[model samples]
Target: DTAVSQTPKYLVTQMGNDKSIKCEQNLGHDTMYWYKQDSKKFLKIMFSYNNKELIINETVPNRFSPKSPDKAHLNLHINSLELGDSAVYFCASSQAVQSTDTQYFGPGTRLTVL
Candidate 1:
C-alpha cells in the first residue's frame, strides 16, 4: 500500500532509447508534479498538473513530457533519451501551493546510461 509508486525504480539503458515512467498517487490529491534532481542535489520542478490540467511547465527538454490522466496519476515519457537525462526522477503531489502544502514524493526512479 504505497501512496505513490513509479514503475521501474531503476532504469538502465543506452543513448537514443525511449522510455516512460508511470506514476500514481492514492492520496486523493489535486495536483501532481514531476521533478528532477541532479547530481548537484538541485531539485528542479519539471512539470505540474492540477486535476488533469497543466498548471506549471518549467523549461525542460522537448524529449520529456508529462501526462496526467486524472488527479491521482501523472506519467512521464522520455523520447530519444540522452546521457544527460540520467538523473533521479521523482513524482510528487500536493493540494495546492497556496495552501503551503508540502508535496509527497516517490522513492525516485534512477535512470542510468552506459
Candidate 2:
C-alpha cells in the first residue's frame, strides 16, 4: 500500500481554470508538504502543514492555497491557474517538520495548461 497518495495524477486544462488536488497519508505523519516542480526540473516547497497549521513559503503566489483538515490530509487549491503553474505537484509527508527528518513523496500530479 502507498504511504502517501494524491488524487487526479494528471490534470489538463486551459489557463484561468481552477483546480483542487487532494492528498492523504497513512503513515501517521504530523507534517505534510506541497512541492512544485517546474518544466526546468526545479523543485521548490510551496506550503507545509503541521497538525493542521499552515506554513507557506514566501515565494509561493497568493493564488495557491493549502488546507489541512486534519493531521492525515492536506489539500491544495489553485485559483486562476496560469501557464507558469503548469508543473508536477508532489505531496510529501514526514514524521515531523524537523530539518533532519526524511520526507516520503507521492507519485506526483502533473498539470498541463494550454
Candidate 3:
C-alpha cells in the first residue's frame, strides 16, 4: 500500500484560479511536510507539521497555505494561483521531525497554470 499519497495527480488551471491538493499518510508518522519542485526541478521545503502542529514554515507566499486537520493529513491550498505556481508539489512524512529520520514521499501533484 502507498505510505503517502496525493490527490489530483495532474492539475491544469488558469491563472488566478484557486486549487487544493490533498495529502494523506498511512505510515503512522508524526511529522508531515510539503515541498515544491519548480520548473528547474529544484525542490524546496514549504511547510512542516508535527503532530498536527505547524513547526516549520518556509518563505512561501501568503497565497500558499498548508492545513493539517490531523496527524495523518496535510493539505495544500493555493489562492490566486499564478504561473509561478506551476510545478510539482510533493507530500512527505517521517516518523519524527529528525534529520536522520527517513521520509517517504508521495507521487507528487503536477500543477499547471496557464
Candidate 4:
C-alpha cells in the first residue's frame, strides 16, 4: 500500500561511483516527473514523461539520465557520480501541466558523496 517508494533512501558513496535510484507510483497517474532538490532546497524539474513519452527535459548534465518503463514508474541513473551530484532526488507524478496539476512527491532519495 505504498504511494511511492525509492530504494536506498539514503545513499552514501564515494565520488566517481555509478549509482541508480528506482522509483514507482501506484496512483494510476499518466504523467511522471523527476526533480532534483539542491542543498538550498530549490526544486528543479529534471525530466517529465507522459505515457512513456518525454514531455520535458531541463538543462542538466549528461551524467544524469531518466528512464520510464511505464507511466507509473520513472527511474534515475547517474554515471560516474560526482560530489556535485550530491543532493536529494525526488520522484513526482502529475496528471498534466495544464489545469493545475499538483505533483505528489516521494519521500525523497538523499545521495551523499564523499
Candidate 5:
C-alpha cells in the first residue's frame, strides 16, 4: 500500500486557469506539507499543516492556497495560474514536526501551463 498518493499526477492548462490538486496520506502522520520544485530542480516548501492548521511559507504567492481537510489530507488550489507556477508539486507527511523525523513524500504532480 502506498503511504502517500497524489491524484492527477500530471496537469496541463493554459495561463490564468484555476486548478486544484489533491493529496492523501495513510501513515497516521500529524504534520503534512506541500512543496514546489521549480524547473531548475530547487524544491521549496509552500505550505505546512499540523493537525489541519495552516502554516503558510513567506515566499509563496497569495494566488496559491493550501487546505487541509484533515490530518491525513492536503489540497492545493491555485488561482490565475501563471507560467511561473509550472512545477512539480510534492506532498509529504511526517509523524511530527521534528528535526529528525523522516518525511514520506508523494509521487508528485507536474503542472504545466501553456
Candidate 6:
C-alpha cells in the first residue's frame, strides 16, 4: 500500500485559476508537510501541519494555503494560479516534525499553469 498518496497526479490549468491538491497519508504520522519544487528543481517547504495544527509555515505567497482536516490529511489549495506556480508539489509525512524523523513523500502532483 502507498504510505502517502496525492490525487490528480498531473494538474494543468490556466493562469488566474484556482486548484487544489488533496493528500492523505496512511502511515499514521502526526506531522505533514507541503513542499514545492520550482522549475529549477529547488524544493522549498511551503507549509507544515502537526496534529491538525498549523506549524512551520514558510514565506510563500498568500495565494497558497494549506488545510489539514485531520492528522492524516493535508491539502494544498492555490488561488489565482500564476505561471510561476508551475512545479511539482510534494506531500510528506513523518512520525513527528523532528530533524531526525524520516519523512515519507508522495509521488508528487505536477501543476502546469498556462
lDDT of 5 by residue, 1-114 (tens): 999999889999999999999999999999899999977888799888889987556588899988888899999999999998888999999998876889999999999999
RMSD of each: 1.1, 1.0, 0.7, 1.2, 1.0, 0.7
TM-score of each candidate structure, all chains considered together: 0.94, 0.95, 0.97, 0.93, 0.95, 0.97
Model 6 C-alpha RMSD to native = 0.7
Clashes of each: 0, 0, 0, 0, 0, 0
After aligning candidate 1 to the native by TM-score, how far in Å is the CA of 19 from where it should be?
0.4
Candidate 1 stretches with Cα past 4 Å from truth are: 97-99
lDDT of 2 by residue, 32-84 (tens): 99999877788789998889988656488889988899999999999999998
Please write out the lDDT profile of model 1 over residues 1-114, one tens digit for every residue.
999888889999989998999999998889889999999999999999988999889999989988887788899999999989999999998877544888889889999976
Judged by lDDT, which candidate is best?
A: 3
The stretch of ten residues in a row with the least summed lDDT in candidate 5 is: 53-62
Model 5 Cα RMSD, 1 decimal: 1.0
- Return the clash pairs for model 4, or none: none
lDDT against the true structure, per candidate, is 0.90, 0.91, 0.96, 0.87, 0.91, 0.95
Question: lDDT of model 2 at residue 75?
Answer: 93
